[model samples]
Target chain A: MLEDKNPQKTKLEQLGEFGLIKHLTKDFALQQKSTIKGIGDDAAVLDFKDNKAVVSTDLLIEGVHFDLSYMPLKHLGYKAVMVNLSDIYAMNATATQITVSIAVSNRFPLEAIEEFYSGVALAAEIYKVDLVGGDTTTSTKGMLISITAIGEAKDEELAYRNGAKPNDLLVVTGDLGAAYCGLQVLEREKEVFKVNPNSQPDLSEYTYVVERQLKPEARRDIKELLKSLEVQPTSMIDISDGLSSEILHLCEESQVGCNLYEDKIPLDPTVIAACEEFNIDSTLVALSGGEDYELLFTIDQKDFLKIKGNPNLTVIGHMTDKNEGAHLVARNNSKIPITAQGWNSFS
Target chain B: MLEDKNPQKTKLEQLGEFGLIKHLTKDFALQQKSTIKGIGDDAAVLDFKDNKAVVSTDLLIEGVHFDLSYMPLKHLGYKAVMVNLSDIYAMNATATQITVSIAVSNRFPLEAIEEFYSGVALAAEIYKVDLVGGDTTTSTKGMLISITAIGEAKDEELAYRNGAKPNDLLVVTGDLGAAYCGLQVLEREKEVFKVNPNSQPDLSEYTYVVERQLKPEARRDIKELLKSLEVQPTSMIDISDGLSSEILHLCEESQVGCNLYEDKIPLDPTVIAACEEFNIDSTLVALSGGEDYELLFTIDQKDFLKIKGNPNLTVIGHMTDKNEGAHLVARNNSKIPITAQGWNSFS
Candidate 1:
């Protein structure tokens, strides 16, 4: 039989990313009653007696993910912890614990790791997440950092990416494009430093933008504000892959359309200034600029009145029927479709 | 004033691995009631109401961790799953779930990942760990693999590295050194194949040994057998870093020493034959060879009688007081001091 001549014996270079994940997870039937969700979304949901547990993970590698020359270990540690915790906050859950793993070669001395952990422990204490469990090992090239964050939420409070309805008001927290601009600024500074080692960086005005990239904060406060204000978002996602990509995610999951406003879109002055300097569109930065770690959500019109005057929440647009299509209302009232220009690491 | 000169910014390579862990983890305060233990153990323990939870992680890299040139992707996937579950089994707990993360470049296609995942799914089915969640991304270099495993156990029934007591029987389950020897054989075969690709590898006699290195099984059966026989080990650890090293870990934690019988040390017939052919001492292999994935545990004298005649159990030696020092009883009844030749990833 042709089946006897197994075709899979070839090297893994033939399978690609999606094929591998699909194959590895085909047989993983969720056996736990508490596992309301498993691996399909931003975070998996577990139904505990009092609250649902939300879990997420992120991996950071030196060189491939970050450059030690520009990326400080402390920021790297803090940023790693923040990225995973942000996934929990995306579901409006309060992050409670985190497991951090580091694999480094003898290339890094004890002090280097201590500096890294000092940042991790500092972030843990700041976020109130217990430094739970992790593994330490040696690598041939550089350090590998992986963090898993776990959070808890009541069943009523848990948010999903699939519940948006037509006429639901779209709300985004804080501003977008600042973090994206922050990255451009850092890259420019790095390039300038390479050419002139004696030149001092005149980054006196981009403090907020730089911090947004280096030590981005999870929207833990928004969860509390929403609880106090009694507003539950029907659908939500984190701004990890920029506003455009995140909006695309919400559309696909909810199987509905969106109509966001260009004028109402939040943009910091620094973002506008940096956009001009980089000769890139400010809207594109907001659309495709990632690593903001902000929350994007949709609120029912009924709760819009309750959340209208709230400073932390800003209304950007509304959801629509699937056939209406996902679009953006430009400044001149021109309509255009929304799309994701996410970072394709493979490319 | 000296603190202002913070040497905390020193390069990571200067502090080394252990120093970094100690520095980063020092300030972590355990806040969860369920966290019976955190880091600094073979595995972290989470005390649930009905059962305890065990957690551990390990990272694999390109050149340092595994050479894909010789290691098949399926075998790599299998080894990754086996190593994590092995830690849970080390805690005398049943592994429940695991999260696997991978970083690959575009050089890999879709079908190759399917082969890797197929292997992972196979192991999950055999071990019954749900493939909870994972992060997939691209790396600039070779592939990176990270696996985290979670387990469940009774509060009082859990075994720790520090629980061995004086006069307790120091017993090791299954055979030792075969996995390490198996690795050596594979390395040799790989080298030979490089010299002559058309020449067939004569590994038929070392089939079991080679398989042990590629796809070692976590002793899930041992946990059930011990439970059915009502034998609760006072102390337990897995043979990932050789017997002498594991024994030292038990003694260091329990604050006790031990003696083992050289003749009583179990060796698979294949392992013994391979060691002889390689001109390596069988006793040394039994002592220092690791990755057996067999559970090495100490049972109190009263509990030893239940397993005395069982084929799966062996009465290798007994734990002794701290003053006695760790030693092994030779075939001639002479005592030889035992020194740990454990896996030192840091070096």
Candidate 2:
């Protein structure tokens, strides 16, 4: 049975500009004490009281970040918000609100924008953050999405990735490589769909992987989990531009070295399978895949037992002496120096 | 000796990223109590206290908002930041910090980037706003600049464009049409250069006009001036998209009509000469050339007495009842309805 495409979807012109914004952020709920107020004002109210705020911004250009051919506008919208929240999480703060600025072309009908906003709203609902305010404009070129996320934590509670000490345990939340595998599956399916008009993407088997890529979650829970575990990490950073690149950032900041254990790295079965099918090295995929939004922190050895048996937590390695330099050990017990291939949009 | 370039000039590479940031924002002193911390942290700290925060974003794409051939990199960078700061200033709040993201191709050598940053840093210093953080990356096409400015003020202190009431006075700061005239001078110079490669622009006479376009200020001084004058505008907005377009936005929000006297409209001598030279309607150019960044505000009739004698403040007209509709009273007594040819990038 063919799905019907409705010809009479509501046009953006039907509702005025303010109406569209109100409709888009109707269900967002503020979830943190630091958010004295969220949205409905000239600016989002961030009453950090005595706490410090962590702010970051990123831009995702159309045709550069994702192709609309296979990537749904809704997923694109959701992922756009995710990438920015990832930076907030990297600073070990709870993201409370975001400003989404989107510049769309005339080719995008009102229905398309609505679908995209629906995805943005859904992510907001799940993340428990407010949409607050943003600027909507017409773009001269392709679609442009600019997101700025604001978060808050106590001045003393905030964790930076540059405070690691020697012997601190290196731990990562959640397994890696699934998102990269998901991307591979999507690219292959896109090619297949281009060759045929009637074929639907065989995405059922790749659901886990695809979701990891298209609708990845920020580690908001990890912040809570770490709190309940009573473990204050000496240093923390989010895994975004590959684990290797992020590890280098931590090393550079701390002025120390690290030794990552190859055997200790965790991978899901679907990720393993996709790596083999794509002829990609699983280890490299895990290290350089990026977009995982997982927490990579250095914890005191004394607190290791608190999260020792937790399935979601994996002890990847340990910090080394300052002169040892950063390296990763292979399965054969040979140490290899780390190199970075961070995300470079300009290229 | 040809002084086209100086090798002894300060090089940006010598300072690096953090040093450049410190060098740029070292002089900006936070004037608002809500600004808990201006810079030196992951994000600029804001303690909104009992007020609501209003945030707005703007993105400028190369070849759309500017023509590099007619614009200096230093001025373009400064103007870009000023435009975004103008938005926050429009809300009548203190603009404390901003996040800037630029996408440039490899064609922009490190020196070119340094030039851009120097301009941005200079603006940050002049405006007294901190350069908190931003992302710099490579672009597939031309340069794209995205800026997000955050500001805070008490809830009642915000001067929304919708707050105007019947019989209110409409006022504007500084003169209009100068920027448009400046743009014309640059375009003419560009044409002259194209005809004869050895030709040099004779721009000394157009200094004020050129500066108005290239290094336009965000009217931060007006905020302080307004406070000193003890006038809280009932309605406020920045002049960017044109006087007609901005006045209409205020009318639509405030639900009031306005009667603008044609003779009272501010204009510089350079604007008059350039408009005459270009055969462009002075009124139309003043209404729609965009990028002035001056304060367009409405004050209650009772408070008009305070600013009536001030040189910087000019009374353009008075607000009328909604039924009267917005119109301009020409010299011949002809009434022309106001409409928006607002700056829409796609259009």
Candidate 3:
């Protein structure tokens, strides 16, 4: 990431606090009219006038969330913003502004931080969201990023996890399990690199899966697409901690049950091939392998015709009465309880 | 502080992610009517109707922001919220909600996290702000707290640091430097404890100063007081770094200069006594000592009479033409150019 040929590093202490903040955030241009004031103030001011405001925050820590050995700092920044924005999209709101805070150890030079912010700026621009205020400071260990995304929507258009009905058709936007397979590929490459420092592994075949893991995009377009298709999800959530975990959350909150069809679960061809190559079950990976920033929601049965045969969406499940319990209908016609074996940070 | 004599420990891995979050936040009641939804959703939803929204965030790293050796986890939690809320109050807005995301190492038990959340709950209750949303995750090192405070105010009632015009009166709420002196006392005690673990140092005389460091309160009431007194600040900021640094921020943002009076700077008797004991100049302590969490603001000349004799408010300076530059009027009536020697996290 260091493009400077001289390789002479400038320490963060040399720039001081204000100078560093100004340098890192100078290129961010406020885009949202709701953002009355951005950085350079005690707090960012937003005038959401009549729109209901939505707020979501996430914390990404090094070693636990991402390994810098394979993950570039630029992609890390982009992924951080995307993760928070995914939560906003789950609320069926238009993501408008975000605050990016970071705490880094002194080992990282000014250029490293600049590279990270460049990624953040790129994500903000691509998402059409304004970069608002945030804090930067020192950390005792590795870097940690905390992002809070703010969005706006009308009261009626907003979606909540508890709005599902018994007949709601469960749906997921885009394909899943690619990010997990991508992570597996990266881990294998890292192991190979450690054993032989000069070895260069060809990653061209795993390009799609690797990109999914490294630069997963939040389903920002899903909300607008659903609007145009006239399908309003009764309940919604982002698939962060895997599909099974999020489905269970929706069922529990809505006081209903879900019956997911294993055969209907969406998966990219790359993910299927990688699953076979790694001798792992693609169904299990789709159910429990997390980090896929896809939108998972349920729509009323009446709206099924509107979303039927949509290439970007798959109806993998349907809501049922609470007594039915959450389960998956396996392709072999056997029933299995859906368990949340998603990634747990603590363990 | 673990007070349970039995000392039975519960590992975080036992509860899992959802259980941990629910256990920590179960007692947080929504106090604000504006909080349409709190936890149990992808994002917290708020209906502000017409009031402008304000957002401020802060990241408090364990070693970088607070030394846990002397800082009780409860007080650390309380101070973390106060630090973020102070920024909102600086905007002349009432803090209504906060999202506190914490990343903790595996070393911290459930009870320790409970103690910290108790402090957070206490602050939220006392301030009448709702604990709307947050993310709790595992870190590779010590604990880090990132708090995002959301507040609201009418567009016309809001204050920004760039509103001060020439001839505006510089005002501050409460005393400064006590938090800094309080840190000195704590550090000295920590050193003493390091030498002899069994030694119990007498900190009775330093009670006020030490408490200022351990549990500093944001001036939440000051905003209400200004409204009640029919006075609005032309420009405002919270003193997180130091007086000199915050003054320079207002000066730079407003495109004006300031002349602060050394005599008018507010200091408690405890701070003065502690400064003498530490063999440090009280003026320098007041100027450069950070983490005061006091409000520094400017008022139009007509409002000066309203705040002049108020014990809670002190007029320390006035805005001047930009060419005059920011300076401090010493006790000897000498002019000294003020420099921002605020606490640099990098250093």
Best-fitting candidate, scored by DockQ: 3
Model 1 over residues A1-347: C-alpha lDDT tens digits? Answer: 11113443332223322233333334334444444434321113233444544557677877766777767878888889888888888887778666677776545554465567777777777777655556566666677898877666666776777778899999999988888788878889999999998999988798888888888888878888998998998978888878887887788778889999999888889888988988999888888998888899998999988898777788999999989888889999999898767654544
Deviation in angstroms for B138 in model 3?
1.0
Residue-level lDDT of model 1, residues B1-347, one tens digit each, is 11114444343333333233344334434444444334431113233445545556677787766777767788888889998888788778878766677776545543444456767777877777666556666666677888877666666667777789999998888888888888889889888988998989878999888888888888889889999999998988888878888887788778998999999999999999999889999888888888888888999899877998888889899999999989988999999898867765554
Which residue pairs clash within candidate 2? A42-B54, A43-B53, A43-B54, A43-B55, A346-B138
Candidate 3 local lDDT, B1-347, one digit each (tens): 44334458888899987899999999899999899999879999998888999999999998889888899989988999999999999999999999999999888888889889999999999998999999999999889999999999999989999999999999999999999998998898889888999999898999998888999999999988999899989999999999999999999999999999999999999898888889999989889998999999999999977887999999999999999999999999999999999888887
lDDT of 3 by residue, A1-347 (tens): 33334458788899987889999999999999999999989889998888999999999999999888898989999999999999999999999999999999977888889889989999999999998889899998888999999999988889999999998999999998999999999999999989998999999999999999999999999988999999888999999989999999999999999999999999999999999999999998999998899999999999999999999999998999999999999999899999888777888
Name model 3 segments beyond 4 Å from true.
A1-7, B1-7
Which ranking of candidates, highest TM-score first?
A: 3, 2, 1
lDDT of 2 by residue, B125-184 (tens): 777666666666555566788888877667667787779999999999998988988988
Q: Tell me, by lDDT, which candidate is best.
A: 3
Q: DockQ, per-model, please?
A: 0.12, 0.31, 0.91
The DockQ assigned to candidate 3 is 0.91
TM-score of each: 0.84, 0.88, 0.98
